[model samples]
Target: MNPYVIVSILVAYFGVLMVIAYFTSRNADTQTFFTANKKSPWYLVAFGMIGTSLSGVTFISVPGNVGNTQFAYFQFVLGNLVGYLVIATVLMPLYYRLNLVSIYTYLEQRFGFWSYKTGSFFFLLSRTIGAAFRLFLVAAVLQIGVFQQWGIPFSVNVLITIFLIWIYTFQGGIKTIVWTDTFQTFFLVSAVAISVYLISKELGLSLGQMVATVRESEYGQIFHWDPKSSKYFWKQFIAGAFIAIAMTGLDQDLMQKNLTCKNLQDAQKNMLSFCTVFVVVNLLFLTLGALLYLFAESRGIAIPGRTDYLYPTLALKSFGLLAAVFFLLGITASSYASADSALAALTTAFCIDFLNFDKRTEEDRKKIKFRVHVGFSVLLYLIILIFEALNDESVVTAVFTAAGYTYGPLLGLFAFGMLTRLPVRDRFVPLICVISPILCYIINKNSEAWLNGYRFGFEILILNGFLTFLGLLLLSKKRVAEPEVIPGE
Candidate 1:
């Protein structure tokens, strides 16, 4: 891969994105930016979600995990299916009934200002950090692999990369994102599919043979029923489900796209479609990993130390320049798709929940939205740099762990509202939500001793939620409402 060629492709690719942002920004007043006027086509929303659900993390991390992150990760995918059902049946109805622009407003309506702030705060803390970390993975590749070798400063590359995300997403929030994300998913999935075909071709294997090969690989195992560790079957299964629920169903970033759909059925349809594509897309990446490992075995190319790099390095080795071009485009698409949406969601949540800008007109709110968008971009820039400075473990692993901690409040809020009948003290709800994860962290830190040598699985979300639920339980008063319980039993 020529350095100049890679840079040129990246430049051209982002130029397309700028056009998307510019045109979308044309009529992107507050409502158009935030809500897409609630007129976006469901099919397009569904299509765009494919990219949001799977980011550059999915592009790089999913396949890499096929070999390294254990074979049992498919348990998470199964959990996602369950979580989507929960979202469709439970969360969507509530959102639709209330007609929420920022979903956190439901917290205020249900539990009061405290709960609303709690939900929004958790979203900001977790999402901002997670998005920054995600963008960092792509930045690492572009900076060290591309820019550093080309004598461009790493900071400058990071700035340019993040600036591009803000440029496109700062306008038309959910509305612009729907179309651009659709465009991005096209190249992202197509590039992966083409690379898969080429890889299969190189090995002289048909699609069936490719599938067969992965099935035979060590990465094929999808379940481990142990309750004691991260691989425990039921534990992982539930944890995986909540991860999907929190990260996708509950998180504003993913749901913003889903919310753009015209109705709950459409959003549910979008979720099902996204999940269907997700399973296959992951299989595609896993199969690619199997092929790459096989290729390495055949050609004696030493695999990289980090499995995450397997795809990029393998693509570099196995494909021609044109394929490489598509590979970078895929990377750009995946990274930007998730990152841009996150920024938009963060800004939307801030404007709606914290600032109450929904009551204001577009002319009065435009500057505020732009300022918040830029502020988030800078916040993410700082976080990504910190991750770089630390230079610790894999960024993807950190992301999964962060999801457990950050999304705990979402799980807690929903569980408290749905599973219990206690009337929450609205003013104290935020404190309860805030205390839950930190308590979880402390318990998680000392669990080995606290649980009498019973350790927790890496999906600490279960514990986080239970802790939050318990806190809410303690804070909430059992109030007898007019018996309106529906006869589900």
Candidate 2:
């Protein structure tokens, strides 16, 4: 509960990260920063990615979501596994074959310059906000847990948080993250596992008793068979699958790490292994969630105003000092893992896709890359301030809502390009992509009135992608003389 103790933990954590940055970032260049010179081991990449994929959002939001949604999230977790398979089999092979630095470059090769820019722009927008959203949640928790007690402003907390991430990441980029994230993931998973143990102990349950207790608890319901609920099994399953593909396979922030591996087989192995770890990790979070609620009921504590507040509330207030230690470490590790990688990826996307990093002289390239990296850290800081001012709902929901719109166009663009051979009118590509999300938004906003009270859930992402696919279909021209696809050069 002491702010000084929390501050001590943070100082030590960043000290270790800076040391890693020092060693790994030495003599690193644009190639090293962007793809770690394609020298990262497959297993290390796999291990580190588990942290990036979970983020601070999962660290807090998923556990809290259990209060309202129950184990229904596990359905979405199941969908993520399906999505990971799609990425491994369908997407990674294409990225490897083309030797892409920015995955969006594939759009340029397939469609035209405008499509390429559109895809990159969407990634920049989606990841910028998504990363900020993740950071915002952690910043808020830290603010509550530490800074607010010390009279520090929320903006200062955000600035400091992003600043620390920028410090370690600005030099080494993905090269640094491949190792740093592995270190962070260890603490992240340990925090969750320990939190579960502590909470169960508070309730006087052993590991076996904890399992039986959660299985019988009201919060333990994992499946929602009701067709009308947003958490419906099939709906969440399908949405989760597509979200994994759109947000991961199609996302540069994630695939950039995968791209750092030595070859296609190594990358595929990373994806598969990461997928297995991801499923297990999320299951652990859900189990922790059930325990948090049961612990709350046992202690006669009121659930916090926001479900997002539930885990932190229990960890900081209900659980002992040791739980608080894990809470701070876990949240900090998870948040840094994702945010640091995002800062690197945004710089990579801008430099490669927008700034022509490949053509610039090495010296000029370094200058521009450094500036872009700083610019994004500032950009994220500003967005988190905005979100702090405006966000009222569960952040996890806000994240997915934003994703359904932003990532949907990406999904459609890639699907149309990969699945269909028809060439699009390259000039109209940007317009179609723009119109798809707007149309999806209007439909989603008015769905109940327009669609007879049928609500749109994460499945809305599927419709958003379908609309873009249809828009692209209308823009499709006659098949060109079989444009040469990448031959896995």
Candidate 3:
């Protein structure tokens, strides 16, 4: 593959997005920047979310998983189905009732400033780390495909990539994100669909043959009963459910779009719309993986140790020009879809939550937004540098594991407040949330010694939630000042 050609294509693609950023981001108010004026077409938000949720990490990672990582990624989607239901019914109502600008505001009402700040801090930390990792995976490809080919350092490449994201998002933030994400999502999925068909053709299998092969393979089985292991079916399914709700429902990047729906009824429709697309799109990617496996077997292609490279390698090896372009375009589209929105949301949350820009004058708001945007770009870039230094398959996996801890408290805090009418001790709220997760981590680490090699899996979320719930029971004292919910029209 001519790396120059790929680089040129990517540069051109970004130029197009910048043009988009210029127009969509014009005359932005704070409300417009943060929530698209809370009037984005719900259907469009639903479509755009496919891009945000399924990053380049997912683009490369999910299909490759089918052959290497037990193919149980599909089972996670099953959990997602249940998770989406809970979010639509449970989380959505709470968010709507509060008419919250930032989701973490609910923590303030349920607990206090300390707890509110605590939750937002976790979200900021977790999201920054999580977004960096996602971009890190895409960075690996860019480093190889563009920068290295042009004799540029990977760090330089990372800076430039993040810089581009920052450039477009600074003006409009989420307002620009919803529409840009829709464009990126379309390209990403289209690229995947094209590459899959081309790869299938090269393998000499029609689409029908490919589907039949996957259904018969070991990778296709969706359920497992062994609770003792991480790959076991039920643990994963349950884990998948919790992961979906926590990551998607509680996540600002995803939920911000949900909140943009014109009304609760429309928002509910958007969730269902997103859910259906999520399942179908994942199935398409899985089928692409199955096709790759069958093709490799038929031609005796040596599969790489890292399953993530399957799509790229196959594209490069077979039917040269079109396949390579398809692979590159798909991967690029996937990365930008998620990463750009991430930059927007990170800026939105920090500006809204911690900075209290609502209290500031217009000039101060712009000044603070600029400084914060620049600072975060630097911070996220540094994290990507470390991610590159570690540069192993398991390193990205570990990054996810670490971020997983942050969600444990989010789950616990939100569950306690929403499910129970009981007041949480406002003063101790932050302390309890912090303590519960750390203790959960300790128990998770020592479980082998504590229970004779008994390790926790997805159910650790349940434990973490339970501990926070118990702590809330122990700590909460006076009822809050009159509930802060303002009546909606």
Against the true structure, whose TM-score is highest?
2
lDDT of 2 by residue, 1-489 (tens): 888999999999999999999999999988899999999999999999989999999999999999889899999999999999989988898998888999999999888899999999999999999999999978988999999999999999999998899989988889999999999999999999999989888889999999998889888998998787788899999999999999999999999999999999999999998888898899899999999888888878998888888998779877889999999999999999999999999999999999888998989989999899999999999999999889898989999999999999999999988877788898898888888889988998898899777678898889989998999899799876255654332
Candidates in order, TM-scores: namely 0.94, 0.98, 0.93
Q: Candidate 3: worst 10 consecutive residues by lDDT?
A: 480-489
Candidate 3 regions exceeding 4 Å error are: 394-396, 478-489
Model 2 residue runs over 4 Å out of place are 481-483, 486-489
Q: Model 1 lDDT vs. the true structure?
A: 0.78
TM-score of 2: 0.98
Candidate 3 pairs with clashing backbones: 224-233, 425-476
**RMSD of each candidate?**
2.4, 1.3, 2.4
User: Could you tell which candidate, 2 or 3, scores higher by lDDT?
Assistant: 2
What 10-residue stretch in candidate 2 is worst by lDDT?
A: 480-489
Over 171-237, each residue of candidate 3 has an lDDT whose tens digit, in order, gives: 8888888888888889888877887788777767687886677789767766666656666777767
Question: lDDT value for candidate 3?
Answer: 0.79
Candidates' C-alpha lDDT: 0.78, 0.91, 0.79
**How well is each residue in 364-395 modelled by candidate 1, as lDDT tens digits?**
79989989999999999988888888856555
Least accurate 10 contiguous residues by lDDT in model 1: 480-489
